[model samples]
Target: MTSPPLSDLTVVKRAGRIAAVQASVALALVLLVVGGVVFAVYLRAQNRQIGAELRTLAMTADDANDPPPDMELALRENNGHISTSDGGEPGVPLLTGATGFSDIHANGREYRTLVVDRPEGRVVAMTDLAPYHAGRNRLLMALGFAELAGILASIAVVVLLSRRSVRPLANALALQRRFVADASHELRAPLTVLHTRAQMLAHRVGTADVRTLQKDADALVADTRALGDIVDDLLASATMAARKQARDRVDLSAVAMSVRDSMASYAHSIGVTVNLECESADGTAGFDVIGSAAALRRALTALVDNALGHVHHGGTVELRVRRDGAKVTATVADDGVGIDPDAMATLFTRFSHGAEHTTREGREPYGIGLALVREIADAHGGDIAVASKPGEGATFTLTLPAAPPA
Candidate 1:
């Protein structure tokens, strides 16, 4: 619709006072230039005609016979007026002074005395510039109107397109909000029922189905706990994503060690070992920090679980805590099927492959654990990084801000 053809058609209705002014200016310039050229050509032609007339008089004077009666020296003159006739002529001979010339312009016309012979008389010619100027004014008026019309159409199109893009975004966001609300409601009851049944089986003793019930109870507890962890992680992610950098006075060093101690019994059952280390500089004790404790522990546990699953018999899992000035660092490393450098790039991305994918043989890594760790780091205004070489070992680091002044 904004094409040149369309804009020109739209001009008659759209163009206004400004277009009219532009057309007037263009017309003025065209008239001035044409007038100058026409005037110059007229002067040149008149000069040539005057010279030819003079040559004809000179030839008449040189002829053997006497000059014509009209050419007699007894010419009548008084204050440059010639009222008398020549010799026996019926009327006075027309001199260059008696004839006048005219010039034409678009709106008006001009006249002037023309005397070609300065020594005797002067002659002049007319410059007809009116027709060309009229044509120029009409052409400029049309183009000025077209330019004004194009600008208005472009503005209308931009407003329409903005409305088109905004509507779909508003609808998609509303749908996602509705979907999450409905799904969370559906998940609550089944999980609570499963948790209660497992506890009941743990208490029942000498009941008719006690033997079978005991094994069922243990499996139910493990799976239910795993499911609970996944749900909690998801909730935490949503919360932290919404509320960035929730900081308080949290003892990071104690949190790391406590988490390791809590998992001791579980590691022992799986033939795994744990070692915890702490190093605090002056003005530091347990490496307290202004950070998110729940998020930090969640991140630590995910890395620990990954480490414990990979380490072999007698192979150790180390949790180290330390601080340097404003920085607090914690590391979890294990001697296992070391991660490949290529996979390290996506190691913390959601659903990425890891050492757990291959080391456990039967059970593949579900993949969100490390992803959560990185998310927590980002939320706390920190970061998580990993370094590994195949056949050697792997180390993961979590770096956070030290506690701030109250």
Candidate 2:
């Protein structure tokens, strides 16, 4: 079992979301600053215009009898009597004691008032601010709507750009993971073979038989070449898309034999027996499928390795291949402490391991091997299944559609 790590795509997606939020905040701040500046300018202009109108009306108006629209004129006679154009509109307040502009709020209305002293008396000019205030309110509402719309548009643009920017990185991360997984899955058995053979060579080096030494040296060289071939295959596979890779007819029996041969030394070292059996309904010699040979071999190797891990020292692990109708099935069966019933559901899930099972090396399975096997099966238009009972052995069957007859 291979240990699962958090997916690279998931991490990238999180980063993209964070980027979008940050971008949105910055955009919102920009819109706020622009809106604030526009509103402030509008307020200053409105105040200046109102002040000019009040000054002109107070200086030029002859009497309170007739005044400009929206403006009210008040006259205080030398006799201490007051007169207004609106018959003393309640909304206007008299401020003859003050001789400067002032904001007056009365009778639930706003007015800008200007008071000036003259020879006859004092002149007070008042203008209603309702229209100006209404205009300001409308501008504020427009700014609010624009700000909201701008922020929403910024978020949408940021999200789209982030996804585009993150795509290449996501693909690179995926490729890296695939390379590591493929290399790790393919190299396990070969590395074990090399280790076992090296130990045998070291033991035989002190022997007097020259032929045995030569034989061990040759075996080591052959295993090293095989390891190199596996590395080359992994590199090629990693560079190409799985669906785009060339698929040829691969003999399942031959693949099982290869697994048996590769695991032979490791199995011997652990006192376990590796066996292979091939059967066909039509009495054919080979159970063939159309797929990547390296991928299929790795799938079979994972199964064999998993079987070897759980089986006892003297237990037997079998690789069985058979053709039924248009399907080719490869089953790896081992007689050892079986899988826990509770752990069966997640057996194929990445990073999921049985707490009760450990390999012959006394290490916990990494939990990804079987997951990779399931993926490989799916890539080749196939599927895998498992059966086990507590204290009994487990059997994994990998089923793939058989290649058409040539």
Candidate 3:
């Protein structure tokens, strides 16, 4: 079976959660309403039966001298003596009251009683309700257990069905990731050859007597390098998107220095100054983080390149590394025109340029740089933060968990 795209994983899981909650709540409500109705009907029928038994006992005692088989009877004389069916006077108190039906407690047992005035004295008939009540209690207890079992069984089925339903989606995601990996690898070869040819052409123009073509050659070199950066970015993004890359202890300080050195020529061409700094003297200890070194280096390069685009000629862009406890940060700060407040929200989103399509350098911001940086940071279990105000320049900080002490 083909796997679902990775992008759908979040949607599938969210939909499952919402569906599970709604189904469980609805099931509980249905069980409560149905159980309540059933219990009410049973209670009403039981009450009617009890009332009928009481009436039968009353009718039997009103005619004959003895009580019915299921009833306890008491006959009182004019003076004080009372005769009872159980040969005990425990039910004598039941006859003292006036006529009509009532509940009585006698000899530690519950009874439904009726009293009628006779020619000689009063007659009281009572039917024990203890057995009926005991049966009802048992029935209610059983129903309660059954409801609990039903809820548990429903939850089990919900979980099983949900997993089965999302299985196809999960499979699609695996296939999509594999395709991205394959495509990136296939494209890398041609891009590398083109980049190398561009380098050679630019180098040949260094000794040629073509003074007028020098500007065009430089521009060609710059465009070719930009294309190479884009290719590397695409590959990095695709590979890191899967979050399956092998990781090792990466020194943010070293990554920063490498980015700074690689961009030195580009910064010179743009007439912008770039600086790299680290917290420690030798920068060997706390700058370490568990991540892919190449991905981190590319992320830092993107930041510096983005800053270079905003800053004017002679403006300074600073790349700094510092560690605090178990966390390390690499921040890129530029003294260029700061990011607009309105643009900050979508700054890292792909193809989300704020003001215009192109930066001050007249080059179109691919909008992929910051987006790729954010992706790489997240893949390494890190995060990116931005602080900027109009005209005050911008600062982008990438924070990661420091590697455990060796």
Candidate 4:
């Protein structure tokens, strides 16, 4: 069974795989951060350990009987001697050479300090917080490395998982492109034959028996032209998708009115009415801003033509044109039996005309709106969108961004 174009799971799946790249990037960044924090903790712990060793050595030096002037604190503290014993004097200094110590308590751990006195009455002290510092650092290093491992593992898993999405999407896109190329190719041969046959039979229009043949030939030519146009539209859309077209300044309002005029005539011939409301403004010399009179007219005409298809007699087809910023917008609306909400999701996909009256299945498809509208809009650096409900009317809006400011 053929699926609708817009929401093809294949495209979404490809898109989804591409999206996984971000997940990979995120995982790598997380690992980097975790690793950095872990390394930082290691350095901090090493610094604390060095401080502790220095203090211990200072205590050892104080034990020496005769020490250098700077080493006097280490000698005095090493001997554990003081002029007065503990509690002998309230204000008596315990060590001869040392400064005060700084201590802190954290996370169920106590950090202690020690002071030593030098012969010069200077004191030196070192905190015994090395154990607490070392333990926390070891914890961070372990956890941080674990985090990095998990991130790498996650990336491996994602790459494997995302392939499921990639293969199917690539297959589907290849299938659709091949189908379009084949169908368009096949139709061209028959259409060329029909066109040639019509021209050859043109002289027989007055003959009684040949008159019918001539009429049929003419009809064949007309139908073939339409078929050729459809093929052209499909090819154009593919071309635009493959290679970007340049953009230029386009006057949207004038274009809208012109297309409206054309559609109005077509409507009259088909016993319907079209209403046009267009407002023009002078704006920019922007980039990729293709709003020339002819192109905008074509875009508007495609929309009007699309609206006319599903529209009922006495129903109105309306068009409105407005300029915004550096870009322009044209909206075409119709009062008719609208589209199914579920179907709108794929409403603008290629080869998406209905299965009745137009295709080999004899269904009345609203033909080629997606292909032509997309081509026209895309060529002008713009886009088209549809809004519809089952019983309510449908609206197709075209939006083109203005050129970049010079």
Per-residue lDDT value at 299 in model 2: 86
Residue 279's lDDT within candidate 1 is 90
lDDT of 2 by residue, 47-135 (tens): 99999999998888777887887788888868887778873464235644668888877678888888887788778988999999999
Predict model 4's lDDT versus the native.
0.61
Collision count of model 4:
32
RMSD per model, one decimal: 15.5, 10.8, 12.8, 12.2
> Number of clashes in model 1?
6
List clashing residue pairs in candidate 3: 3-171, 3-172, 3-173, 4-171, 4-172, 4-173, 5-172, 5-173, 6-173
Which of 3 and 4 is the better model by lDDT? 3
In model 3, the runs with Cα more than 4 Å from the true position are 1-218, 280-285, 356-360
TM-scores, in order shown? 0.51, 0.53, 0.50, 0.47
Score candidate 4 by TM-score against the native: 0.47
Off by over 4 Å in 4: 1-177, 181-214, 280-297, 324-327, 355-367, 375-381, 403-406
Q: What tens-digit string does per-residue lDDT give for candidate 1 at 49-74?
A: 54454345433332212433322211
Candidate 4's displacement at residue 63, Å, is 51
Q: Which prediction has more favorable TM-score, 1 or 3?
A: 1
User: Candidate 2, clashing residue pairs?
Assistant: 1-366, 1-367, 2-366, 2-367, 2-368, 3-366
